[model samples]
Target: MSLVRRIMHQGFMPLFWLALLLSAALGLHQLETLFQWIQPDTRAVIYSRDSFLSLLLNHLSIVGIAALVSIVIGVGAAIAVSRPWGRDFLPLVSQVASIGQTFPPVAVLALSVPLFGFGAVPTMFALILYGLLPIVRNTLVGLRGIDSSVLEAARGVGMSSVQVLLQVELPLAMNVILAGIRTSVTINIATAAIGSTIGASTLGDPVISGLVNGNTAYVLQGAILIGLLAVTVDSLFERLQNSFSVMEDRLIK
Candidate 1:
């Protein structure tokens, strides 16, 4: 039990990412051999050559950029709203985030396509918007929940406002902030699969192609890869949560 806990605290994100890459690059392409026997009637309509790897890479790249953007904006906004000078804007912030999420990713893409043209730009715009709400909400919740006395004590110690926030509050709130990030990233992973409709080249390529060509194999392949990717990243986030718990305990002690 202790050993398992230790490993969780060490973080499994790197391993999960590596395995996801290897499986998508090698395992995904070879899957047709096994799937062929199950659905002999349907022809494989997968990417030509090892283009599956390129598709997977492109998929990861776009999602990665979107998630990165979402985190920056979400976390920054949450921090600003949590502060004294920014408290009045909390409602405005909440409303904007709610509206961002309420607007469908497909609509965001469709509307953006006219301005940005078909490809990664529109898809990324959609993804960043789609991913923002959870991050901002979670961060705001975490910061709000921090013990007032903790901040008071930090301030009492002659620490400047910035020092208290960076050295004390941020660390204490990190786990909660990360939980919001996990939710943000997890939701975006599956949402990003649909980015292919706008030509962003993701695991959704097979799903879109399969639908167009009426080949279940293509759909299954895409779904399997995308599902695995989501699950793997979720596990990584779980590990990160565990790791932060351990770190938090150590800091408290």
Candidate 2:
């Protein structure tokens, strides 16, 4: 009963958002009347070049792949630099990550098209580059933010360096790290839409097509789905972060 109640509290918003996202992707054609009202002059209101569900899936795949790579590289770099031997390279790593973010996503895509050609590859590359900064920065902050006294205590209790890092530092820093990931993923979700311009199949296809053809309905559909996806992912991350915080508090008590 307690577990059920807890799941209900934590799962409701994410589930709601997920339901809306899925419905929009799978059942958007049902809203043709609404779209027609929005774009009365246009012959076709709902985007039909490709299915919304397909676009949504492709978008997720791009963002998911980019985010996975970003998390591994970001978290790994942060952990490495936090150690004694690697501390000297921290500034260089941070500067590189920041520079990666400074470049515009569109610019990166344009630059990548020649190298990678027009497809998901360039989009994923752009997303990975653009999404890296937040995760790396947040990871650095999280790992660096751990209390030195607590770390010393861990060592005092005869824990090795690896054990202290694994058992003490990572756990304490997880919430902040998760926040960084949340931000990165949210940013990638929106930016991934731009990839449609470069021939990447994403939810942004409708928006790009709508703009090119002056069809507002298509734009609205794409925007709605993209917005819903971002909200859903952010909410899920919030729940996870909250769970971590609760566990940390109980441990402290």
Candidate 3:
């Protein structure tokens, strides 16, 4: 197939288009409301462009940083615990990640405020914690899911322990690991909205402000934007997972 055709067939295209449509539609709706509010005779309060942009940037930055941290920690921890010596520590790590997921994002933000102090720090911390579980769990599952015979074969072929893991196990387990990272990223995108609650500027700022002032339009705008972002990221991850799966299949064959 031609490159263009292959690109079109990939799942990410449709998702990207869908996200664009949603964003455009939502943005237009928001703009109309904003224009109406700006009229001198209108009773509604106007939302400034600066504030809106700041809120969006804050959210993007927080989610991006959180996902980055989660990837490093989650993947690193996963790799660590997959080894023989680290295997015994897996349950404890799993339990901790589970606790992170169970813990309220807001509560984490609140607790972290004192130590991390406002802005994006507390928000990033909460999101990192919230996003760790899926990646770590998936890493463990992926590494463990590798066929024992395959691992033994690699070792018998004179591959070192590290070589067996890096060259044999990890390649086979890439699909599951990518899937977990995708899940963690998408969840973090949604959860990052809570950052606005504790004085961290994010898409949630509009929603929270709208609630305070009883403005449904603003709330809807923020809600739509946040939802679109999450959908877009999720779709991208799905494509990545499919690609990884295909690679694993080809490797096995």
Clashing pairs in 2: none
| RMSD of candidates 1 onward, in order | 3.4, 2.1, 3.6
The pairs that clash in candidate 1 are none
Candidate 2 per-residue lDDT over residues 1-253, each given as its tens digit: 7534665687889889999999989999998998888889878999998898988888999999999999998898888987889999999988887777777777877788898999899889888877878898988898888888999899999999999988989888988999989988988888888889999999999999999999999999999988998898898888777778887898778
RMSD of 1: 3.4
C-alpha lDDT values of all predictions: 0.79, 0.88, 0.74
After superposition, which runs of candidate 1 have C-alpha atoms over 4 Å from their true positions?
1-21, 42-46
Error of 2 at 14 (Å): 1.4
Off by over 4 Å in 3: 1-9, 12-30, 33-46, 49-54
Better of 2 and 3 by TM-score: 2
Instruction: At residue 73, give the lDDT of candidate 3.
Output: 90
TM-score per model over all chains = 0.87, 0.93, 0.84
Model 3: per-residue Cα lDDT over 1-253, one tens digit each: 4434544577766567575845654454456656466443535544444355566666778888888888889888988986777889888997877776777666776888898887777878878887788889888888888889988889889999988878988788888888888877777776678777777778787678778877666676677777777776677667666766676677878
Clashes in model 3: which pairs? none
Q: Give the distance in Å from residue 138's predicted Cα in candidate 3 to where it truly belongs.
A: 1.2
What ranges in model 2 sit over 4 Å off?
1-8
Positional deviation of residue 190's Cα in model 1 after best superposition, in angstroms: 1.4
